[model samples]
Target: MKQSGNSLIEFLLVTVVILAVTASILALAGQTDKKRVNEELSDLATLTATAERALGMPQGHYEGLPGKLIDEKLVPAKMVDSAGHLQSRWGPVNLVPIDVGAKRLAGYSITYTNVPSPACPLLVKGGPKDKRSIRVDSVEVGSFGNINASALAQACSKATVSITFEHHLNEPGKRSL
Candidate 1:
């Protein structure tokens, strides 16, 4: 009877330790994901500002700005892979020109593909808010200033998602999209 009681206690203690370890691991993973998301957002903002500075005037179009950024070494070295493609933790990062009207470029768009569902909301809500439009999986959720939480939740419910950030030019003499 004494040995049995000791065995039971030992079993319970081991189970408790396992549960605690699992919980700790989960918490750590969540923190890591959050940190990565924040880092990606910061990188995106830096890329936007750098591109704007390098491109000067809109010139009515910003086609191929992604390649230009890569060529000029404007992108962070860590984000660019060996093949010179811009990559994020989830997937590829693409930058394209946003044409307003009559081939006039009003702004640019940054699209992150293959984004995990869990990170979708974080990416959307954490992006630069001024003069930016956000879309999830090709569905327009909201602008930076007026995001709908419900809409975001619905749109982000997927195994993989794509988030696009349309950054309109807010400079002098440039029209905002």
Candidate 2:
């Protein structure tokens, strides 16, 4: 008499198909998560820079701040990640006022630091005309604040990847280079 269920070969074929489909789904899910994290990082960088510039305008200096930027409302109040860390999808956002100008009135340089895990390098693309486009994994950090064209180029090299929003205390509502 014939067997009542699937043959050995048929059962093995079905199992293999199921495993392959499951693996494909998992791979896609991971990619989607990475994309979401990258987008969140970009948004956080832009928002923090803009808020910091606004905060410094009235003071006429962007350096020697007294408190964490989050307290100043420069960063949105969001629930901490699963790890309970005050950070974006990447990691902690460190804003360092690089160079304070004379009397702190010439507009200071602010560096937005997002230390991504080595597995994921920070990647961002600027406007078409904007020269600050990151195309590689590592880059030399450059100076900001009323920087010269050459300095800007070096700071915004293809190997470098970061977003900088400039605001001069002298010019209200004016976006910086």
Tell me how far the alpha carbon of residue 88 in candidate 1 is from the true structure, in angstroms, after superposition: 0.7
Q: Residues 1-177, candidate 2: write the lDDT tens digits.
A: 246345776888999999999999999987876776566655555554554566555555555432445455455555133443344553554344433345543443323344233212323332112222222223432222222444434444433244443334444344443
* Alpha carbon lDDT of each predicted model: 0.81, 0.44
Off by over 4 Å in 1: 56-60, 170-177
- The per-residue C-alpha lDDT of model 1 at residue 17 equals 100
Residue range 1-177, candidate 1, lDDT tens digits: 999999999999999999999999999999998999999988888887776776735453576788988998998887888899988988899888877544466578889999888889999898867646789988888775679899999999999999988866664443443
Stretches of model 2 off by over 4 angstroms after superposition: 1-8, 58-60, 64-68, 79-86, 100-122, 126-138, 141-177
Number of clashes in every candidate structure?
Answer: 1, 1
Cα displacement (angstroms), candidate 1, residue 59, comes to 3.3
Tell me how far candidate 1 lies from the true structure as C-alpha RMSD in angstroms.
Answer: 2.6
Alpha carbon lDDT at 14, candidate 2: 93
